[model samples]
Target chain A: MNSRLKFLLLNLFLLCSLSAMAQEKINIGEKQAISSAILNEKREIWIHLPKTYNDSSISPAKYPVIYLLDGEINFEYYTGMSDFLARPPYADMPECIVVGIKNTERTRDLTPTKSQKKSPVNPNVILFGDSGESENFVRFIQEELKPFISKNYRTQDYSILVGHSFGGLFAVNVLLTHPEYFNAYVANDPSLWWDNKVLISKTKSYLEKNKTFPAHKFLYVSQANNEEQNKNWNSEMTQAIEEFKGIVEKNGSLNYKHHFFESEVHGTVSYPGNYDALKFIFKGFRTDIKKLSKNPQLLEEEYKRFSEKAGSNFTPSETYLNVVLKFMKSNDFKESEDYFINLKNSLYPKIK
Target chain B: MNSRLKFLLLNLFLLCSLSAMAQEKINIGEKQAISSAILNEKREIWIHLPKTYNDSSISPAKYPVIYLLDGEINFEYYTGMSDFLARPPYADMPECIVVGIKNTERTRDLTPTKSQKKSPVNPNVILFGDSGESENFVRFIQEELKPFISKNYRTQDYSILVGHSFGGLFAVNVLLTHPEYFNAYVANDPSLWWDNKVLISKTKSYLEKNKTFPAHKFLYVSQANNEEQNKNWNSEMTQAIEEFKGIVEKNGSLNYKHHFFESEVHGTVSYPGNYDALKFIFKGFRTDIKKLSKNPQLLEEEYKRFSEKAGSNFTPSETYLNVVLKFMKSNDFKESEDYFINLKNSLYPKIK
Candidate 1:
């Protein structure tokens, strides 16, 4: 072949290869850093907005927020999970913004009481020496992090705090120390045994003072299978959780759920625990689409009931209304379709 | 102010604002499209590599791949879940490459038979008009898609097929027809009643012919709470699943598990179902780090047993080995630490 023709063929091959290799990224969220005065350090957070949050066709919507501890470990699955659960038509819960807090001092920030112990594996070494500054950490979350999020994102009043292990201890500490901070709390196999079960005593004192958990509050605690851990180093972990479960169940005032995961170890419990917590926290959020197709008015009634229980007002999302409209339109339910269109317009007025 | 000074101030303000708003995306995967000869159409696929896939410190690793149906709906969460479950120290399964296939013609590609029925919502309207070309679809996957993946990625021989609803039906159909295609199959709330339970008959005939499933193959089926569905138009779905479950259990030859998710509905079952399916498929894959500290040889023994059952030669991943070495070194298990170092060096030899 001539030199010019050879060069032309090479260029063509390169062009085809480049086109074939062109790829699009699947981005779930973004990383943002904030300087926290309370903690006296810069904290990085990962924020994930729900799928409909940026849809141009729909009116902008506010979402309930979840403050996830152990951001680096849990953020990806947690965001994916919340989105899956919040899909329209069969949404188990409302769309949510997940702010995953990355750790600067994991032991110090998550432990409730300053304590030190010999390492389980090496008795000569000390562990958790710099532990127990959760008060300052919670302060940072409340005074700095929450404001940063609210100022930046379209967030609803309703929020949830979720954590595992020491992070779970931080969640319970926050609920005990500042009950009004979050609408719901999830602690997955928490280190209730920390400082000899300090949180259990705090829970008792709070119940004695308040007589019942502040109205409309919810707490979901998941206990991992301790049969193995009991044989290992964390014997007190399961016992403490069981003791706490009895006290809360006896009080029967807090909207409380305690699930014992028989098959999961402490390391694995948070995954399934988070799923169950969402289901429990938003027990009445799922509205039947088939029923809605028949009785259009039932949508408002269900929302009203759910709002009353959630202690927060929540209207149907514009995306959900659109889904309902499509379902009704495809089914030839003209009246129901019209009903949902009106509902959508009333809730999310088009700016133009 | 002087004009030059004013311009400098404006430029400084712009730089500050831009830096403050700078964001990094959390990307899980990438999208790629390929033209399929068997199906005679272009198909898009989302590919998610494990977190360690591109780590410069580690050698390139070949990984088991999961072919997830309904890429648009399930890719995000499925990728996140796999990564979470594959974390070191308590890794439940091996890190895997996830290839999610996006659908073009849903009914036509997923259904096993060309059949049409009246729309459940609108009796006058027909549904699934151009139904049934799953044979062609499977051929596309086997002949075109699999080769495309194999050529471009570092892939282990083992693979899994996962689906829900119509996609789930497609997975089961493939298992019966092309049992050797994948190592495992997961079907969440599968539409077994599709085309009048055609797959159930196919399963019966396959069992009759083979007398037993191929060795080392696994299947997991999850049934959702069909109470609401039973009251609706999908009354037959639950019965059909139950019938399939009975027939499979009676055969007692396939490595199988059937779970009933009492809380999950059809639309929401896949989230939890996928988690359970992974645990079931890789039941003995988790090695105890605590135990390994004392008995370093136990790691190889466990992997051997697991591999024997899996019919795939499994070994400890470099990441898992690193985690183990760290655990041992920190805990002062000097001998065990040395043992793991040698194991890692032998398994992942550095190119010097």
Candidate 2:
């Protein structure tokens, strides 16, 4: 090739390569060690901030943080879900930060009690097997991790604790013992049957002594068919919560929701339950889809509230309406259709 | 202080240091390229075979394969879902080999047409822009990739094609032009609006001239509010299909299903849609949940069918029942509850 042609081709190649590299791999970010404490040695952490997080033009923005356990498995699931949920109209949920805590010793960190027999993998190893360290794990979160996160990120006071299996057990333990730690709690098919329902029994005793759990929301969910197995332990867990709900009703301090996911199981119920939990806990603040349809002004008012509450300068757009409608329909919330139409009318009143 | 003690302590320190070094970081696998003659390039591919896949005792079993596009992003998503789905009753969706085609040039490979406007990003200056390289892409799968995959792995003829967005568009293109490429095609929020509805228009033309497509299943889905912005165009696309549906009904040679995701978006709709599509498409082949509840024999019959079809001697366990029930409830297919129960009963008649 000619010298000029070769030079042009080289420049073009460099530009294309740069552009391809710049397209941004959809990575949330790298995993990093958040704490150096000896107990925190095996624990790694990952955080996902939204794409709009760095935009200074979008000011005064703060996000709710979701602290998830079993980060190695669920970090990506929540990250992907949060990314899509924060996109448009059902923009009811803000683009929050997701903090995933990787487990070092799942049994030690997640379980409240040191049950020697429960752990079948190792019978001889004392410290490595059935060694309870949940109290220390919670301390790590409350003292070290939370403080570091609050200092580093633009965050709202609102926080959520999510867990599955043993993680679910940990979430419940935290919610019961340190209720002030999180605004919302989701226990996805928790092992309430742990240690012959030690947690459940302790929960019953805790409710007797404690009059209230503040203004926090607790969602206890179980999959449908697990009722027939293990002597219907899931139903019993729900019943225990129902008893706790009675105590909360008498005290009028805690708002508790019990959902029996008759279709879900221990492992696969997290996805739908998590989505529903977010919707349920925020139901009080949800935009009135019905009222909005009758009046375009209502939709605008709701958007204003969303922006104000989320502490972001988010405007309701066409894309937003599409997203809201989609989420509503998928969750079988069809009653909100007219509200979505009203939202569309209000947002793009000039289009027609 | 003794010389012998000092030597032993030094050796212990060295061993501890080596162990720490090994445990410090995770071993992320190295990237590799897969050669394909049809594309005439070594495409980057990601392969994840399950832990059970390597077991020689389970040899001579041909596993089903799932081919995913936008592998870099959606590969993990499907991997997680498949991991969860294959566990229990939902185990109807067998454990399969996952092949993720990592994108080197997404726009070039994914887009069906080579438009001048969108072609500027092409580095090769091959004028593949708007040139319709989908045929070549399909040929690469048929001629090169498939042969390589079949040669390397014990793969059954049953294969599934999963794609999202532009990848989804490509999936639909392959399904229409080359129906025999895969047994099932999952097009999640395909960009039917691409090139001003070029694919949909082409589909209309193809259907008009065609006598019938092969015996295959096609799943066309759109996120809930996706229709709100370009209602006219979206409706036009739907109308085109409806027109084709009329034609298909008269001839009765093809099987197609259209799902309107009123609650999902282009980005977030894939999870629910993919789950539902798999459930719906494979509904009849598996034991009817309701039937299984009433008759233990039905569950065994369904298992036999599943085993025969999959070419694997897999049986549904209690864990599988829990997972399937969880999935059905999460998707709000409560009506299928009876069928699931029946299937469970058939699988484990003694339990019920």
True contacts kept of each: 0.70, 0.08
The TM-score leader among the candidates is 1
Query: How would the docking of model 2 be graded?
Result: incorrect
Candidate 1 CAPRI grade:
acceptable
For candidate 2, lDDT tens digit of each residue in B1-352? Answer: 5565556556555655654544433222113467776677789766655434655532234567888787765665565556455544435366677787887667667778865432232333334354457777777777877887899887767788888767778887887777777877777767665666677677767767875665445454444344344433455444543453454456666555557666554556676677666665454444444334345456667767755643345565555466557655654456556676776666556522
Q: Candidates' TM-scores?
A: 0.93, 0.61
Please list the residue runs of candidate 1 whose C-alpha ends up more than 4 Å from where it truly belongs after superposition.
Answer: A1-23, B1-23, B231-233
RMSD to truth, every model: 4.9, 13.1
Q: After superposition, how far is residue B344 of candidate 2 from its true place, in Å?
A: 23
- lDDT, candidate 2, A275-346, per-residue tens: 666656555343534344335356567667655543344455455466556655544455566567666666
Specify the highest-lDDT model's number: 1
